[model samples]
Target: MVDKALNDLLTLWVTIEPIGTVVLFATLSAHLPQAQRRKVALKAVFYSTIILLGSIVVGQIILSAMQIRLISLQVAGGLILFLFALQMVFDFSHERPATPEKGHDISVFPLAVPSIAGAEAIMAVVLLTDNHVYSISSQFVTACVVVCIMSVTYGLMLLAEPILRIIGKNGAAILERVTGMILAALAVELIMEAIGVQRWIN
Candidate 1:
């Protein structure tokens, strides 16, 4: 049980990448007022948790109904995550506000969706809870791990301002780029695992 818990914790932590979320959150919300930043952070975390938990509950059913294989989902998710990482590393579009008037409600756009509850994170939860491999109780435990990781992510977002104060914008940008590289590596690993190379090696 301890081993399962630890494994789930580590898996969720890597897929969710809370530190990268914190850096991105800090970068995006730097221009907002303190109260607004807090509100956005809370909403983003709440929404992401709901989305991830919902995926854990219904993702398998949806996949089965669609006759989709977990391996296919893993590969597709890896491809999408790779594209997202490339955007993080090379795209400058994220630097522009959605609209000049009010700026985008980034809480929902990037923060909640791809930043916190990303495709990789969603696939991770579904894969972890797979009924064929994991017992119901073990799946429940994995769900709990997901919540714990999200809680840690929320705490990190709450500290974003202080972290940004120390790191500054340029430092945050560098960290984001490094995180993108890590994400790209993770994506490759996912694709390799989906194709059975990982199992062959083991």
Candidate 2:
């Protein structure tokens, strides 16, 4: 159980990407007053919690309803995650928001949706809490882990300015690229496990 929880924590950390999110939050909220920035951070985390928790609860059911197999989703997610990792490693600039879109809530648009609770993150929660593979109690534990990760993200966002100043843009880019390499390896492991290659090798 401890091992599994640790694995879940690492997986959530990679997928939820608190460090990258902090940098993005700092950039996006740069113009806002401190009080407003706090509100935006809270809203982003709150919205992300709703989206991610919903995915944990009903994601597998929705997949089953669509006649999709977990293994299939796992493979697809692995591929997508790999591609995302490549983007992170090779071209970090693509993720940075241009000036906030007019009339759009930046908190919900880029921050909550893709920054905090991205497609990879959503797929990760669903895969981690698969109905067939994990018990209700296990799923509940995973949910708690998700909340913990989000709390960390929120905390980092709250400290974004200071953190960014300490790390500098180049440092953050280097860190993000290193994280991308780890994520790339994890993506390959997911594919191998989903395809039973790991079992065969074992």
Q: Clashing residue pairs in candidate 1, if any?
A: none
Q: For each candidate, give its TM-score against the true structure.
A: 0.70, 0.65
| Model 2 residue 46 lDDT score | 97
Highest TM-score scorer: 1
Tens digit per residue, CA lDDT, model 2, 1-202: 7777899999999988898777667755655667778888999999999989999988778877998776785687678768767776787456555344466687885678666787678888998998879989899899999999989889889997676567766776676677668668867987898889988998
- Residue pairs with colliding backbones in model 2 are none
Off by over 4 Å in 1: 67-104, 167-202
Note each model's CA RMSD in angstroms: 4.2, 5.8
Per-residue lDDT for 1-202 in model 1, tens only? 7899999899889878898888778866765677877888898988999988988889889877999876786787678767767876885565554332354467875688767887778888998888789898998898899889888988889998887778876887776677678768867887998898988999
lDDT of 2: 0.79
